[model samples]
Target: MVKYVEGSFNEDYIQTLGVNFMDKKVQIKSTNITFLIWDLGGEKEFINMLPLVSNDAVAILFMFDLTRKSTLNSIKDWYRQVRGFNKSAIPFLVGTKYDEFVELDFQDQEEITQQALRFGKAMKLPVIFCSTSHSINVQKIFKVILAKAFGVKLVLDEIVNVGEPILVYK
Candidate 1:
C-alpha cells in the first residue's frame, strides 16, 4: 500500500506475519475519504482476526499469487470466511506478482489467467492482475474499489486476454 500512496516501490517489504493496521486519505472526485486498511496474513493462527477486518468493510480484496496455484486454491476458503462476516462488502479478486508470472511458459500463463477469470465470474468479483514491484495496476485497483463502493460508473475498458495484465471491472 505504500507503493499506492507514496508512488515508490519497496523491495524489502516482508509479508504480514500478523495483523497490520494502516490508513490512507484519498480524494475521489470532490470527496475526501480516509480508508482504514487491516492486513492479516492468511495463517491458521490469524484466521480468528478475519472478522475484525471483514466486518463493515466497504470492500474485501482477496489476493492470490499468480505463480502459485496453491495460493489461488486457498482463496475459496478465505472468501467463504469473509463472506460470513460481511456479505455486502464488494469483493475483488486480485492476482499479484504479475512481473514474475509473465516469466512462466505461455501455457501456464493461459491456464492461470483463465482460471482467475472463471473464479472472478463465479464470485462476481472484479478481477485485477498486478505487480507491486513494477507498480502495475496498483492505483487502478483502488480507483475501481472507490467507484464500486460509491456506486459510481467506471468507464475504464476491461483488458481481456491471456498473458496480459487484466483489469476486469465488470
Candidate 2:
C-alpha cells in the first residue's frame, strides 16, 4: 500500500527485503491534515508490531482483493487486530482490483459485492471498491477517509448546478 502511494507500482508483490514496516508522511490535498501513514507487513513475524503501529492511526484502511475471496475473509482478523490496538480508529473496508473484477461473470461480481456489503454493514464501516491500476475511486477513498477522520468536506467538481445552461454557443 505504501509502495503504491509512493508512486512505485511496477514492483513485484513478494517481499524480498527484511523490512517489516514503513512509515510515510502524506498530505491530504485541499486540507492541512497530514497523515503519518504506516504500512505494516502481513507476515506472521510482523504481527507483533500491530499494537505499536496501529494504535495511533486516525483511520485504518482494510484493503482486500476483489478477485480473491480469501483476502476478503481475512478482513475479520485484520479488523479485530486493528480494533484491539485502538477501538477509536475509524476503519474503512476497501475492495481493490475493480478493473480486474469487471472481467468476471455477473454472478461472481454480484456474490462478491453482496458479501462485502453484508460484512461492511455488520462492521458498521463504509465500503469502497477501487483499482489502483486504473485509478478508480482512489482519490474518493482518501476524501472519504479525511471527511470521516476530521469532519472536513471535500469540494467536489462533480456537483452540478441544476439551473445552469447545458451549452453555450458563441
Q: Largest lDDT belongs to which candidate?
A: 1
**TM-score of every model?**
0.96, 0.77
Can you write out model 1's per-residue Cα lDDT over 84-130, one digit (the tens) per residue? 99999999999999999999999999999999999999999999999
Off by over 4 Å in 2: 2-4, 11-31, 154-170
Report, for every candidate in turn, its global Cα lDDT versus the true structure: 0.90, 0.68
The TM-score obtained by model 2 is 0.77
Alpha-carbon runs more than 4 Å astray in model 1: none
Clashes of each: 0, 0
What would the per-residue lDDT of candidate 2 be over residues 60-96, giving only the tens digit for each residue? 8787888888889989988887898899988888888
Which residue pairs overlap in candidate 1's backbone? none
In candidate 2, how many Å is residue 83 off?
1.0
What is the Cα-based lDDT of residue 53 in candidate 2? 72
Candidate 2: clashing pairs of residues: none
